[model samples]
Target: MPRTAPAVCSAVHKTDPDRPRRAADGLNLCRGCLKGMHRNLSDLPWLHAEVVTSMPTTRATGSAPVSGSRTPGLPVNLRAGELHSQMGHDLRTIAGWVAKDRGIHLPVDGRVGSVCAWLAKHVNWLAASQYAADVRGVLTELVGRAWAVIDPDRRPMEVGPCVELVDSTPCDGMLWASVLDVGDPRPSKIWCDGCELELTPEQWYRFGRRYEARRRMSA
Candidate 1:
């Protein structure tokens, strides 16, 4: 008996001619190309990649009747469906919080280029905290979410779209507020009652030292 060859990867499959999971895009991608693209979609630097679109069909096709028939975007690692999901926003919000918390400072944009640049620069020296002990862990999670969005078959973890700072007890709103002139007046914004007591004695001490250090830096 002779063996039957598998289907060729020439064009996008029928289920989704726009987005192909099991095949690679090209005039005719070989089995190797398909596999490589699949693997690289979730590989390292995947988090650093962005999904972008080409210009309108008129620019490329020289046809006016096909005005609405703009060329479909080809995303080797990005897709519309993936960027709009829980995983997509969760990773992005976490990046913002981590950057703000560590003073790395990446803009709160969903695009990967700028965020990845910031990640590249500060990931080495960014001090770990209770929220993000492992920087790589968060990066991995981010990549996982990106992969999940691009590839429907892969099951990704559930995530909150927005990450918030929560107190152990229910939030009752700010008890009081004060401002100090440390060269600049920045409010000591306390969000809840008893929130001050939630920190351990050591944590408070460390925080005090940091606050004083910043004050001195400003001075």
Candidate 2:
């Protein structure tokens, strides 16, 4: 015999008997419905999309880009807003400094508001942390998870790509962009134009060989 489903989510489990339980709340939700909810709430197009739809439309009107427009769109549901407010207040109490430093904004929208729900459940643990690193990690993890939901369409990082530096310096680590190529050479970080200037002859040759190997492997 099938186990009785919670009245709150009976319809949810009705659709899919095997829907994942998203929280400690014991409420089981249909996986398809959860994905649909995620799609509705987490699709913050403005952040990921470079080209704004309003740009050309506004240009046609002979006006400057709309400056006062609020950020793309927020989740319009009342429950989502309440959840965000609740999370904000709780975070401020336990991890106020970390939240402020990290700009902890809870992005919630649909039925699967599971991320927000999870954070709320763990607020007490996050607050009782003594180390700043642990607190920061929790906050960062929450934010990163939110982003993962918001922008699900991520391209894999390619071998030949530039990653930004953690800090900035006048002669910063190779002027801040880690120019990734075939050879995974260490950053000389000194102000220089070429490998000949940045590295010793032996270092350059050894690094070149490694780079070639990396290229072949990747290929």
Candidate 3:
């Protein structure tokens, strides 16, 4: 028997060299990509639900006379509405294609949650088929969009120790930023756990610059 070359992952990643060449025997995507796809598929239902729930709506405060333009008011959050629709449409379209191709019975109602559950269940099976890249791409895009709408500031990070100096003494606390605050006006809040110091979103950049300067001076 002759040895065959391994198939490269079809999924695009930030770093090409780090992509795994050891894809499953019959799949074009690596194990990592497939795992991520499954996880995202599972999360899609929740994310889509969040997007729907978080959509901003307006109610008649007092039923004032509307004679200015005679136009109907639209949904307050058009972006959220668009995202919600796209998520459902994409999930149903892909699921339908997969069902037809695999001869599997899809959910008759084609609800977003049902379609997502179906996709998550057969993610590996899809990975082995010719539509691996298409499925992965769609899943990734939908997941990213869903997150952007519901939790745009979810990437909390430790921004190094507290650099706030009090009488030539640095506060012995750690500074962190980007606390999860869905629909919050102030998402980028930097705070210290030890000294109880806090910085607003507007001051975060200045604080970072000052911290860097302090580091340079100490070095």
Candidate 4:
């Protein structure tokens, strides 16, 4: 059976009108141009291989926007003073209590940084027993209240009726204590306390082991 040649488009012929017509060979190319066309097609595999090798495989996912770029779901305007005012109020409350207890009046400006530094330097020194007890009481009350404000589950632990003095020369007392839910480790220290009976080394060792055991059990 004689096979009829397929119809060729004028645009393809215009490019190579002198080329002779032949069977399509399923490649859509005339026989005359088929050799050149197959050569180009053969180069395509290598061309694709080079392109794939050059192209990067890994691309970064979504990243933080550069400065000044529009950010979705973020507040467009923030009031600087409003944020500071809230923080200042908390600090002023702490400062006010410290001033009243120590009998050293300081401006309760509601900012902790400067006021705490000033109080540390300027507060009047009292006898160790009076000072230690006063400081401990103040801290206990303030910390308990502060934690209660933020934490729904905060409960005050039953601290000892005894104050354990660690250093006597300068009267530094260390109490092995834990906050119920706040999870602050390392015992709180009350300084300048006039006391003779410091917790012995054995007591510290036992306390440390118990504390560790409780922590592991909780975990």
Ranking by lDDT: 3, 1, 4, 2
lDDT of 3 by residue, 1-219 (tens): 633323866766433445344566668776556766875676677678878865765222344434454557764557678889998888888888788998888888777888887788788778877778788888878876766666444534678766666335554556667565577553356665334466787876776787799878876
Tell me the whole-model lDDT of each prediction, alpha carbons only: 0.36, 0.32, 0.68, 0.34
Q: Which is better, 1 or 3, measured by TM-score?
A: 3
> What overall lDDT, based on C-alpha atoms, would model 4 receive against the true structure?
0.34
Q: Each prediction's Cα RMSD?
A: 24.1, 17.9, 12.0, 40.5
**Predicted model with the maximum TM-score:** 3
Once superposed on the true structure, which residue ranges of model 4 sit more than 4 Å away at CA? 1-110, 125-140, 152-156, 163-176, 179-203, 206-219
Query: Which ten contiguous residues of candidate 4 have the minimum total lDDT?
Result: 165-174
Residue 82 CA error for candidate 1 (Å)? 4.3
lDDT of 1 by residue, 1-219 (tens): 532222333323222334322212221332323322222223423333322221112222233344455455442223434443433455466567666776665665655544444444443232222332233334445554554443232222221111112222222222222222356332233112212222233554665565456446655
lDDT of each residue in 109-193, candidate 2, tens digit only: 3223344343454443333323322433334333333333221233112223112221121111111122333563433221121
Models 1 onward score TM values of: 0.28, 0.23, 0.59, 0.26
Candidate 4 local lDDT, 1-219, one digit each (tens): 633324331113322345433333332333323322222222222222322332232211243333464545433212222323433454455456657776777774423445444444432221121232243333333333333332233223333322332222221222323233245432332111122332334565666566466546655
User: Which candidate comes out best when scored by lDDT?
Assistant: 3
Candidate 1 has an lDDT of: 0.36
Could you tell me how far off, in angstroms, the CA of residue 106 lies in candidate 1 after the best superposition?
3.8
Superposition TM-score, candidate 2 onto the true structure: 0.23
